[model samples]
Target: MNKPIKAVSFAAAAVLAVTICTFLIIRQTHEDVLSKEAVIKKVEASYEGKVTKSTQSKDKKTYEMTLENPKGTYFLKADATSADILSMNRVKAMNPSVMTEKEAEHLALKRVPGTVKKRTHKNRVATYIIQKEDGKTYEVKVDMQTKTVLSADQISNKDQQKTPITKKEAKTIAERETGGTADDADLEESEGTLIFEVDVDLPDDKEATVKINAYTGKVANIVYED
Candidate 1:
């Protein structure tokens, strides 16, 4: 009886240790995710030019901003303890196109190919919220002028002359190196240094994370969304 009790106690202690370590690792990973999201939101605001609408995460460490004028949207991450530049100057320019709300929705749908959750339009440019099969949402931008999609997928900053990295290459790199799936990874971009980012799917249906790396295909970090 003594021996059985000791074995059970040891097992419980081992389980508790694993649980504590997992909790700490997850907390640290979550912070990394928030930090990267902040950088992305800052860069996006700089390019799109405004924070017309904003949403704050429950923890108050993340923000999602919708831009005015040309109408782009971005998600921002901020630290409760650390202050970061969450603002950018607006660019004065003509709206991409003068579009009716309905027209804008149609255009946005064409690009993202999903049910419209919400939409906003100014002049001819319109932005729409589309949900992926995973239930994750992505903002889509449509150009009424060219009937073109201006969402994150299309706005990659790679050289106009250089062929963009295909989805396969991205997957192969992630698999061989990071041991992460590449299905959702798209060729985002790298400046000075080659960089790419892939959104990682977590266990939850609607939650996901992002992974970024250098051009040599070295992964920098993995970022999670709550």
Candidate 2:
């Protein structure tokens, strides 16, 4: 009797061990993430540009990719297993066509969740300023042609006031910073950061663009054209 019982116990232990190993193997297979090539192809099919850079997370659960097209440079995060888009945002944009007020308003509400109060357009981007009943103000920038949102920012009460720096002062600061001859500067505002973009002349027919803060007269950026 003891011999038979010992044999049955041994058989039960073997069966349990086999079941655990199979379960682990199945789980690992199910959790396997997609390859980098597969994720890139998935994004290219939906977006216009090819993936220029891709990085997988440490856990291999998601991929962050950078892509460039005529429209803009976009950053996208996608699920590694499902190849589903987790998030996408354009980091930079090229010139887009002018969008109408009606269209801009429609697009603005989708991101801002407020009633459109006023609209403005500059640099080929349309901005719809919205006001919520709670007295919160939001600014939404839309790419007029693509109808995609470039950014959505909330405006603090302090930003509603006029900027302190004058146009002439902005040009002077930009010229001083770049040490080049400045032309008429254009005042531009985004995400509550006001800037005066000045095109300046250098020697030998070269040109440089200088961007200065409109409020603080601080130099923001300068780019040289070859």
Which candidate tops TM-score? 2
Encode model 1's per-residue lDDT on 1-226: one tens digit a residue. 6999999999999999999999998788566554444544564555655555655667556554545545434344334334354554434445455455677677676666655554667666676656544434456877777566777343123332122345556566656553445557655443323345665444454333444443234456665556
Off by over 4 Å in 2: 1-31, 96-226
- Can you tell me which runs of candidate 1 are displaced by over 4 Å? 35-41, 56-64, 70-226
Pairs of residues at least 3 apart in sequence or in different chains that clash in candidate 2: none
lDDT of 2 by residue, 2-86 (tens): 9999999999999999999999977895568889999899899888788999999986789999988888999999999989999
Query: What TM-score does candidate 1 get on C-alpha atoms?
Result: 0.27
TM per prediction = 0.27, 0.33
lDDT of each: 0.54, 0.81
Clashing pairs in 1: 97-123, 97-124, 98-123, 98-124, 99-123, 99-124, 194-215
- Superposed Cα deviation of residue 177, candidate 2 (Å): 62
